[model samples]
Target: MKNVYLDNNATTMIAPEVIEAMLPFFKDLWGNPSSMHYFGGQTGKHISTAREKVAALIGAEPSEIVFTSCGTESNNMAIRGSVEATGSQTKVITSRVEHPAVLGPCQQLKNKGHALTEIGVNSSGQLNMADLRQELTGEPTMVSLMWANNETGVISPIDEIAALVKEFGGIMHTDAVQAVGKLRIDVKKTPVDLLSLSGHKLHAPKGIGALYVRKGTRLNPFLIGGHQEGGRRGGTENVPYIIGLGVACDLAAKNMDKEIKNVAKLRDKLENKLLATCPNTSVNGDRANRLPNTTNISFQFIEGEAILYHLSDIGIAASSGSACTSGALEPSHVIRAMGVPFTAAHGSIRFSLSRYNTTEEINYVIEKMPAIVKKLRAISPFV
Candidate 1:
């Protein structure tokens, strides 16, 4: 069985180059970045360099980048911290299709007496901008929306959304964990106040992430302790993972064009083949306005977990929805938000690709999927 990984949206394999960059930090540069000694200073300089590299990937300044433990922490820092800084009276707005990281924090805020509005999405999983516009009124607001849907790969119109938020004097935050490596983001052009990114979504190691806080954004610190991450996030830095993340960012910037072209080609090939060959199958989300390396398909009359089990047996990894919500038996909130029928909703599978995927690997999955779907449907009681 071939080892094909189509679960990049969950987490990616660390790049060899990123590993090489991190090795020296683990063995030689094992010093606290906060220390005043020479070894500490040397490690601290690399953290600064990593900060710059992470900022460069999204067209941000080095000073605006705040290192966090992962994307969830970044989301929490942006959502909870911004609300704290903006005062308890601020209303929170987000979409219904957001990852649990964004939605979870927003829900907590709601429980704490903050006014929370969840904007709905269209049948194609596109954000309802009109709804968002309506909600932007009536209070000083903070809008936290995902730049791209993790399950369906639907890209939000963030540039327009951010501009609208600014027009209403609202703070805008984006969970760009899936979008950072897949899309070209320039924070200056978009005018978003805050954005979140995770390292593992790209080719960097897990347990490292960053938040881009725009200059002059009044964000209260999420973690309170010693002054680390410019007094934003307080903790000892993960030096090796930070260095790995920086190298991964630099590599992503250089190869983005090729990644967009090659990965999309493979994604399209897989999506198109499965839709054509499998009966009662349909693609989800807005095909024209989605990420290049993602596809969500629903196979009617079958359960997604079963498909995944069979696919895993053949070494082809996929997902039913966000890995964060994988164990829940219910269909994903994302698919349910799009109003997909119960028959299709429970059967939806997401295949997210990466720069390392090859044509041969894609072809192998394409060849194997139709048969698996047919067999599953044969036993499916819904059929």
Candidate 2:
């Protein structure tokens, strides 16, 4: 009964190297970065080093990086901060399939009298650029779209979107939490105004994230307590986790090419095998432009929660896009946005792989998943 975890999108196992890099900060060098003494100075230097590492991973300047609690905070800061900085504008634009981090803040703003335009996606889960162009007709305060879909792993044309936002005189931001390590990110190349990433999504410990602000992007501070994070964010930094995240980013930069090729091969093998073994199944999203290490498959006429329970019995971990697991009556917003049929949308399961995942683990899941699905469907009333 081996434990095979494929739910990297929810969180990932912290890498041993990252833990090793972080241990010293927790043990001997636990000083407030703002302290005036030598101990604080040493810790502060490490923070600066960590900042450089994170910035390098995304092709940003160290000055442009601002550490925050997690991806949610970063997203909020990027959305709310940019809008507030540009006081004259009153509109924010984003897509229908963004993670709740971005969507939640936008909805909150909409409730507070700000105009919010949520662009729709096609049946393939790709954004309708025409709709985006129409929304950008006005002087939008900001446009926040995700670089990748967490459930479907669909990669968006963020570089193109950023260019459009620039033309329309709107600030551009991307929640790149799921895309940061798995894909190549060069802020210089993309020219986005702001970007958010979580450390936990890339084999670093949780509770640490970063926001990248392009130089000269006017953004009001989201958290204003102290002068830390260059007066952009104000809190005692989570020193150890920040150091861990930096190591993880360095590791990601070094290993991304190999990880992409190997993980994609493993993911494709498992997905193809599962689809072949099951009936009335379909893959979600545009398979051609998806994250290399993810596959979302829909099992028609079955409940995803029931399937999850069956898989759990075998020590296999996966995530469901179904509304049943999300405490809702409707299916996944991502699947629904893509126009996935009601029959299939309720049963979509997301399997996200990591660099640590091996062919053996994928094969093990492929061997067991078909039987689990068959058993569940046999008892499903909808079938």
Best by TM-score: 2
TM-scores of the models, in the order given: 0.98, 0.98
lDDT of 2 by residue, 1-383 (tens): 88999999999999999999999998999999899899887899899999999999999999999999999999999998988888745698999999999999999988888899999999889999999988887565689999999999999999999998998788999999999999999999997999999999999988999999999999999989889999999989899999999999999999999999999999999999999999899999989999998899999989899999888889889999888898999999899988999899989999999988888899899999889888888888877
Q: How displaced is residue 144 in candidate 2, in Å?
A: 0.5
Error of 1 at 123 (Å): 0.4
Error of 2 at 206 (Å): 1.0
Reference-based lDDT, residue 286, model 2: 89
Model 1 agreement with the true structure over 1-383: per-residue lDDT tens digits = 69999999989999999999999998899999888899877999998999899999999999999988899999999999999898989999999999899999999999999999999999999999899988877478999999999999999999999999999999999999999988999998999999999999999998999999999999999999968888998889999999999999999999999899999999999999999999898999999999999999999888888899999999999998422337776789999899998888888899999999999999999999989998988897778
